[model samples]
Target chain A: MTEALASAATEDILREAAAWRDAGRGVALATVVTTWGSSPRPVGSQLAVDQGGRMIGSVSGGCIEGAVVKEAQDVIADGRPRLLDFGVTNEQAWEVGLACGGKVQVYVERVE
Target chain B: MKRDLLDSLMQAQRRGTTCAMLRDLKTGGQGLYINGEFTGDFASGPNLKPLVLKAISEDVSGRLPEPYQDIFVQVFNPPVRLIVVGAVHIAQALAPMAAMAGYGVTVIDPRRAFATDQRFPGVTLLNEWPDDGLEALKPDRRTAVVTLTHDPKLDDAALSVALKSQCFYIGCLGSRKTHQARLNRLTRMGFGEADLARIHGPVGLPIGALTPAEIAVSTLAQITQVRRAKPAAPQSAAA
Candidate 1:
């Protein structure tokens, strides 16, 4: 069931990215390419962001969407893809909100 | 001209066809593969073809081989469907639950009063006879069919059609005696014991369900169990 939802989300991300590009809005896509330990979302899960910071779908359930969206804005601006790593840090665990103690690698690229 | 890969993929999804999209990370090339053929223009060579086929067959998405490590293959499969024959009380409950579980549900009953939009909101309602409705739906391997109308005139036709199709689950609501009689009838209709065994008559897990909603839960649970059961697992041995 989670897989099905992820697949649907991937499709939605692609559709939304294409629509944003067609409408002349800068678009970038962030995909969960790899994860270690108890990541909330699985690999292939995606989150799409347009120039105006409008977003759809998710790479992490909730722990790091804000961070991804923040980075996605940079990817859309510079047109340079970025690889982001998020994990629990002793002092920053509370700040990152990743209490589950897992690491996630996200690949954010401009959809051009 | 670069073809719109997303548009093509959306079309394939709407048409219920299995397809895969492969993307190269380094070079940013993309290709759409469908029905054993590659349609879009991409730079990945023939070496990655087998991996694409494997991904589609497994219905999974992941990175490619060593040389193509940067590439990603994403698979798309049609949505699962559930067909409930007989707009009985159980159907009213099961349809919504199945829909919530991501199944496209269709309720069929010849009785107009029973098969109504009011009774089955947001479900596809067919006031046609069972056999005709099943024929039209053409239940496939991704489909689950449940017959709740105890009347053989309705259930027998639904069962016959579902049994012959590739539907993953087929259940009929009845008691043990009624199921035995149903098996006898189906046997007379030339269905072998092996074929009849595929059915879960006296449908639903024996959870001591007393109400319509509880029965619906049991039925849906049994269907999900059958749907996800690993075929290689020994069934009788587990029992």
Candidate 2:
């Protein structure tokens, strides 16, 4: 059997975010700034996105990444950050909320 | 996020220095907070630095408290550390187990034969007196200490250092009788009831583990319980 590595550290994601910027790709970093209830990812969990539609890391297990990526690309285009809130109680709950019914505040900002 | 600032933050992170990435939600500006120094476009006054510092030290990442509500402090703490004093069969099982669970494991034993690379390949082996070995490691808030030598000379010295420091977990392997005797010794040595209470005598979840590997699993499981389990009700925060 293959050995399972330890939990992937935040350094790996941040390093990838930095490398993308250095390579001249427009990258946007989405960080889960806050979480309430049963969030799969912790408050500091992140999702890195490039303008090319590639992504790394995650803000939620799998439920909210698509919406966060779309918002991230917008931030990359405008060079202005935006915060997206998702939860069972939100107005856009059905379309983008976490399946685990957790609440999270994701701050998306373009990497300069 | 500025390229230079990200580079500097990564440099600090690589060096195992605690750092925080701060963002002003109102302005969408991001910066790095490392070693009490702020590097970024946003102005971090006296009021903001301590909040970031608190977040880093507490290993909590979230919005700043009242008055500084606009900032989000994202803490990046160094790896959680585990120091096992003994390097015996239990340690041989425990060291790699703890490492797999994301703890930076260090095994301390003055006996070179016990603390060797043959037994512990990637684990940090400190073949010094337990107290001296622990002191050199400079146990911090993120550290966990376990004494399994079954020798008071080694276990007591390690306990003295661990109890006095902010390490999150202190476990000593011993039975009820041995634990009571250990407590008596520490009490006589000037540790009060509150200080002595921190030691997890028998040092593992009471699953009646018979083998060294099973004991290691129990100990590591207890460490996880202490590390991840919240002290109070989660309901209040969710509310």
Candidate 3:
């Protein structure tokens, strides 16, 4: 049902993250640690990525997800968490389509 | 984060518990905050005390101040609940309004005709004695209890349960003279002035509300004021 899927999407991102980890795959969680004005996603919005490039949830809605996913892959590989800054002063903000012009700081950490 | 820690957080979420997660970026130290119970790799830091309390109180997620600037606190809270212990006219208006304000509203009345789904559509209806219904509900600190039935038997039974629990707000519909009489009865029933003081006598702000909707607005505004003015987390929790 649509309700079940929607609830899973909104309420179970961490559940999916744990599921992937339990299945013997490396998992990474990308969280919007902080935001400065007009950002699409509020602080604590999260994206979960597995080793095979599969990702669930959205940190920046649509914008900056690809970049976060790339960083998540590196976090999974190195087991070293990363803090990514986007928008305003970051040149990659334009390339990544963080079109809102709001600054967002994302913290990506591997689930070990 | 440890798999066990993630499991703990997931378990709390499943139980509709309010909690928080803290992570130190520099040290990779992680902690979980639950009803002042701290657990995890970084639980022992005294400086994390006030930050965790403030973070959960405001339902905010952000970094700590300098010295522990890299520490991020993420809060998770369940929906607020409002238990209306009557299906009267005020409840009819209040239920929908409180739901719009993001409280999961429930209406309780033993009279089946009054507590009908037709009268209170989309609200959880409980056609049971007030005491039994409230006992089953187990109102937590995020819950608000309001008794609107003028009958002593119904209001007192609900008040007994509401007084014993940690509900953030308690309001009863009555005039000042009626509330004084009610307080006398409750006093004889073993409640002290300290416990009775929690009840908002002649409930709702003194806006001279003439209509049910206006009274509901005043009552909801009073509840909001009470909740905002008090510390969301328990006081004596710093230890």
**Ranking of all candidate structures by their lDDT, best first:** 3, 2, 1
Note the chain A TM-score of all models in turn. 0.87, 0.89, 0.87
Candidate 2, CAPRI quality class derived from DockQ: acceptable
Stretches > 4 Å off in candidate 3: A1-11, B82-125, B129-239
- The TM-score-based order of candidates, best leading, equals 2, 1, 3
Provide the TM-score for each candidate, comma-separated. 0.77, 0.84, 0.61
Candidate 3: tens digits of C-alpha lDDT, residues A1-112: 0001112233478999998998999999998887786788777878999988898888886889888888899999998889889986788855885677788889899998
Q: Report how far residue B224 has shifted in candidate 1, in Å.
A: 3.5
Which candidate comes out best when scored by DockQ? 2
lDDT of 3 by residue, B80-180 (tens): 78999999999999999987765778899999989998999989999999999999999988789999999999999999999999998999999999999
Model 1 lDDT tens row, B52-153: 777765556677767777877767776678899999999999998887765778999999989989888778999999999999999988789999999999
Worst 10 residues of 1 chain B by lDDT: B39-48
Candidate 1 residue pairs in backbone clash: none
lDDT of 3 at A5: 14
